[model samples]
Target chain A: MGQPKQERAVQTRSALVRAAAEVFDEYGYAGAGINRILKRAGLTAGALYFHFGSKEGLAEAVMNAGQDTVEPLLESRGLQRLVDVTLVWAHRLGVDPLLRAGVELSLGHEDFADGAPFESRRELMAGYLREARDLGELREGVDPEVVARFVVGACTGIQLYSRQVDGRASLPQRVKEMWDCLLPGIAAPGTAQDFDTGVARGERLGRMGAQA
Target chain B: MGQPKQERAVQTRSALVRAAAEVFDEYGYAGAGINRILKRAGLTAGALYFHFGSKEGLAEAVMNAGQDTVEPLLESRGLQRLVDVTLVWAHRLGVDPLLRAGVELSLGHEDFADGAPFESRRELMAGYLREARDLGELREGVDPEVVARFVVGACTGIQLYSRQVDGRASLPQRVKEMWDCLLPGIAAPGTAQDFDTGVARGERLGRMGAQA
Candidate 1:
């Protein structure tokens, strides 16, 4: 196919995923209708099937796309920073149907046999925790896996709660407060004080690890 | 009209709720069929409707029942202890269909009506945070509402993650670790150490203005 044709195909697929996310967020996985998704995407059923094999396939694609957007924020900043960033991202993204859809998609996967399609998201978070631990940001004898789980759990809780409360509290500020409470217990005794100095100085700790 | 008839009606309704929870947990809110629930409860369709009115009504009943079980735990322990106890309760409950149903019901509400259903849960948590602050368990200047949100968020996150990981980690140990991290940020300076010491002395802090 020529470049123009390829570009159009890619655009159509992207639009479908975006539309699918909105429908899924509003109606959930079971309630979401494939016909509605196709209509919203400005495509027909045949075209959607051509791009994604079935409704489940489309849901998975939408989930995968959201993870792509969220995973990097977790990786680059490390888990702690990821928590902070996600709160800000959630607040900024709140009320936008697409982001809301992404959150619902992520949460709804809890019971899947392959175990939450956001498996990559968990792995990425685990990796950041390992990195954080190796750098001595985590306390001596603290289990990185355990801490990682806690961090992930806390973030999930914050996102859900913030989305529920919406205007009453700032999501970003709530995220920071959570991190502050959590860091002191998990951080090597002295590192907890670093955040007290401010976020910029705290960011430097990620680079100045024991290996550095 | 007789006492026996009233008793039988109550029993039948309870059986239907229990059966509905199991079906809902297995198939999700939208996926669970009323017929299946009726079959499992060994009741006719008329009986089910007489009890719950509709599928949404049935879901609300399931939620109300779970909340009834959960409310006392919240009232007695306040927030921090509630997290600790819930992990224990989940472990004790094991893979019981009822607990699984409760989790599914919660996930189903993810997209429902923005956020009203969660308000009671949020309020119970906030009440604990206020109590903690009054007892000098939390920092003097921290907002009780904000701290409560974080605690709730962390708990929600941990429950979802732990349920996913299943045998990979001990839920109670994970809960302790979360508390370890979170307590420091919220506790009044040096109060955590005192609180830790006080626990051994059996000097529990009285409940804060929790009802508010």
Candidate 2:
């Protein structure tokens, strides 16, 4: 294919993935069909199959296609970075289809094993927690790996409930409240004071989010 | 028409519901079939239909048939009740088919509107939190309703992940870890010290479980 066609194909694939995410996020994997996705993307059947051979393939791409909606707040690191990452992700969970769909697809699908990156996120959290512990930031007797998994689970439960109750309009606030309630136990005394455990804090970081 | 026949009918219905929960928990509502549930229950199609008219009805019954595996810890109350309730529920989520199935059914089904008693659980938690606040057990400026909902969401996410990763064998520890991280932010200063916040705490509570 020519250069223009190659570019067009890529754009079409991206569009389909985005559209598929929206459909799957709303209807889940079982209910999501190629027809609705194509309709949403304003493309033809040939376009979808050309990019993703099947609905499962499209879902797999969507599941793995996590992109940072905004660049991190440069000032944050360690335990604070973990908090910022979650808060920002919560905010985006309200507005971002790809991320939200990945969560929905992962939790709702019964047999789809490659659905959610449960481990990758856990590892990322553990790494930050370890740094926090090493730097004398974390409270004594906390296991980074255990707490990381616990955090991931809590976030998962919160998002699922939030989505069910209100389409996640309240997620950022809920996440902030979560941090407000949780950080005191995990962070060393007086260490969590510097962190702003508020939805506004996350939204500010989101607005300041720049492409990496 | 006889009493013995009615009692036998009750036994069969209980067996069918248990079998259905296991199946629904494994395959979800969309994937669960009447044939498999019947096989698990060792009943005929007629027996299943006689007890639960449809798969949807069976799922609804499974979701509503929640039973607490442990009595509330007597040593815990106020802010501690919130911790015990969550931890106890977490331990049960690992062992109790009814509760675990309820979690699975509620999270997996899309548009199964009469699903998971998420609001009910939040209300229950909020009610407890309100008492905690009235007793001066909660931190200053904390809203029970908001915190209750947030706690529910966090638990929902954690349980979903736990079920997927392990047969929820780590649920008690995970729930305890969650309490360790959260209580500091919600409870009054030094109030959380009374709570054990450990897997053994949940296990001990489980041992004293009684039918209410």
Candidate 3:
């Protein structure tokens, strides 16, 4: 329990989460064996037990960390900010193991330590949609909470399909097309015309986010 | 083969497919055991191999059959028919084990027979959208293929979320909400005004499709 020992335990826990995320991302929860996770972390059984009681515990820890890693970027306002958040998240999915694995785990239909692994993503996006509504950025008929749920489902599905199809090489375009297909219905007339849905927008935003 | 033997083989194959679908649906591809599939079918290894070469082969057969079970619901015209197709399919996802198992396999992120399990569904929806475009049923500036892909992704993700959160009992409403959010952007002006996206529509159409 000394300061140095405590620091080392924290580092060890982080490593375990990262390694578990990789294995889960690649092989899924059912396929990700505890033996493989231990081997990947280079930790002994005693050490793993001290940190996480079981595979389910490890998965929950990873999900919590991944959700934190995906905290919304920038302090910008309006519906464009919502679009930016989604696009940047998509770009990050291909590059960030924690996130990619977190998403994989979320879709597995399991209950994580933090209620549902994806509940935060849904709530956060819903908050943004509510803001957009308050600002008159949304179309007259659109319901912010309902539209927010659509966004969550759409992004989740897009990423799942992209991963299954091609390791997400086409995610940027798919994200853009998703917006292109959706904005016309929900955005205030003519306001979404200038918003960037291109791959480049996400790449740039993601890069900025990492530095920030 | 003799005529009676061929008929028996056909019966055995149908039985195997049904049993495999149930196993695969409940346990996923990786978790589905060959022993369990055989036990469920009440068949020997020789009988299984005679129809499907291996577990992979069996999964492929299940996926192909699932896709077929999901054939477009109505031959009606316009975007409303597109809406009907989506709604009917959502209702079926809960009631049909084959479709459910096939979807589980497709989302398993593996290579099954024919190609990726979801490719044909996307292509078929895209084909429908193209026809809608040619018939002037699409809104100006909307791209049919792009919308089709969104539809596929949205539906896939919604079904997944619904399954995890509520055993897919909420699928009909989710599908309805999905269309409510997307149609304003894609449907022809004044055309989507009266389309029914309620669960009742799906239930009614699904019953009709079954009777037909």
RMSD of each: 7.0, 3.2, 2.9
- lDDT-wise, the better of 1 and 3 is 3
Note the residue pairs that clash in candidate 1: A153-B157, A157-B153, B131-B208
Going through the candidates in order, state the TM-score of chain A alone for each one. Answer: 0.75, 0.89, 0.89
Residue-pair clashes per candidate: 3, 7, 0
What is every candidate's C-alpha DockQ against the true complex, given to 2 decimals?
0.49, 0.61, 0.53
Tens digits of per-residue lDDT, candidate 3, A1-212, equal 55798799999999899889999987878788988988999987787778888778888788778753324556567687788888888888878888888776777644542326445667888888889899888988898878877788788787777777787898889999998988888898777686677889888888876686
- Total clashes for model 3: 0
Between 2 and 3, whose DockQ is larger? 2
lDDT of 1 by residue, B25-53 (tens): 77878789999999999999998888889
Candidate lDDT scores, in order, read: 0.63, 0.78, 0.79
lDDT tens per residue, model 1, A70-172: 3333334444554544453444344445656666666666434344633555565677778777776777666766666677677777776666677424565
TM-score against truth, every candidate: 0.74, 0.86, 0.91
**Candidate 2: tens digits of C-alpha lDDT, residues A1-212:** 55798788888888998899999877768778889999999999998777888888888889877556563344777888889888889877776779888877676665565324787789888988998888888888778887898888888878777777777877787788777777777888777677777787777777666343
For the predicted complex of model 1, DockQ is 0.49
